[model samples]
Target: MGNALRFLYGQCCSEPPTTTTTYGGAGDQQLGHHGVSSTSVGVSALAQHLYHFEITSQVPEGLSKHVSSSKKAQSNWYKKLSKAWRESKPPPKTPEEASRLVIRTLQRHQRPDIEVDARAVADGDTVTVYVSTSDAPESSRVPQEVHMAAVERNEARAHKNYTKADALQKQIKDAGYGVLHINNEEILARKYRIRLRGIDAPESAMPYGKEAKDELVKIIDGKCLKILIFDEDQYGRFVGDIYCNGIFVQELMLKKGLAWHYTAYDKRPELEKWEKSARAKRIGLWASSNPEMPWEWRKNRREHR
Candidate 1:
């Protein structure tokens, strides 16, 4: 049971969602009028690793094939759920449908050799699961191979052996999973912070910075978020695509000119369309005569310090 959980913690957090929607009514509401910046000042107060992925490897050849097959089935279920969310839209009905979809996924996952125990955690909405071998009465609750793999993986991470960590990360990803946390470090579901991929907004102190965050808060504060991490930035933040209730938040940010397309890192050439539109419309940050990019601004701040 423990081994399977460790593996899951490493491989499952979220996936990129499809389509997009906007919470347009937000502008009328006076949320955080004092407009204190949260992304850097108050936010940087809490320390975080720039990047991390969690998962265990080392399943044997025969069993690994089975596991991979199971993962494909799981992925299909998740994709369908995402599609439904986008098609049906968010709200009173969406939540019920989403929950039922999850149950359906679990039911579909039933297998004779595995007993899947899943329950809601006290911390928040995330549901954790335990997978035990039920092939034989004498079998260990946590498969022996998975347990040993986790042990080795943890030892490598403890020694700062990132080479092993990277290899293990690749193994986990290839096997169709994403690690949400490592070693039980984050005790709360809210600690699962995801950064917007393909773009970076100005710091809180910078021009329009507060506006960007305010827009984000309006859009995602209560919406279900899906993140697909492609890589991690130097700051240790997971660099990934963010979907808020099936809407592509990054694209919206660009549409509003609330963020700069982080070309050096993500290189989303298509984002130029939204950026051009925002510039023509003189929206948000583009309202400034000559606004500084967040990357250059951060560099200047560091050099001055």
Candidate 2:
């Protein structure tokens, strides 16, 4: 009995019993021996037990699939959402992109289409972007009208119709205006006197003073001129240069010795040459042995008064 018990114990504890039957007792007892025991199971049964425990204690297949699918859908949704958000934002820092945005906004406003050269815009200032239609009318070009009038006068003078030309001159003088004839078709007239650059013609008729005025009238009587208005003088006359078809009227008068320049008001440094030429030629007031500058003559007259 002791030996039999030891054999049964060895069969159960050894690697595995290779034999199909064990020497227990007989038919019923043999059935008992064949019954299932913990140590006597096959490899398939052991694998099934491990699989069952894993299913119960660990994660399920259905739950893991659902979780992975949810994560993937969330990642895709976030990518699309970020892309849509970026579309409405301001442009990047590049100059070309920024300029395009500015120009588009400006075009929406009704402003002038003046080509803006490259410039930096300040913060908070309103920028102009559109074309404007409020420009001066074509028929209202003042300079062009003056030029045409000058041409008509010149044509009259050229045909030796002195009466008509003289009448025009008188009309111009009476109107407190000067005429500029530009080319044969353009004339300009303004009801103002531009101080002749480099020379001052006297207001009253002194010796050679009327002659100076007459010379100026002859040269610019019916010409078109560009008047650049500077400041006004104490006498309320606008002091500026008269450009006849772009020629400086003052330079021509000075070259002809028709006028003497007032040095205090004439800023041209080159007038010294003209002065020398005038003195050498004995022109205008220079003909007198003691010719007085208009300012000095006025000062002396004031003192005598």
The candidate maximizing TM-score is 1
- Candidate 1 lDDT over 1-305, as tens digits, reads 22222222222212222212233376643211012112222111110100110012222222222232233332343344334333433311222333453345344443322111112111111112222232223224434444334344544666889899667655543433333332232100112234667777878788787677777766555445556668765755556776656888788888988888878776667787788899999999899889998889889899994
Please report, in order, the local distance difference test score of every candidate based on alpha carbons: 0.45, 0.42
**lDDT tens digits by residue: candidate 2, 132-221:** 111233113334333344445555765889988778766654544343322222122334433544466544446666666666655554
Query: So what's the TM-score on candidate 1?
Result: 0.41
Report how far residue 232 has shifted in candidate 2, in Å: 1.3
Can you tell me which runs of candidate 2 are displaced by over 4 Å?
A: 1-190
lDDT of 2: 0.42
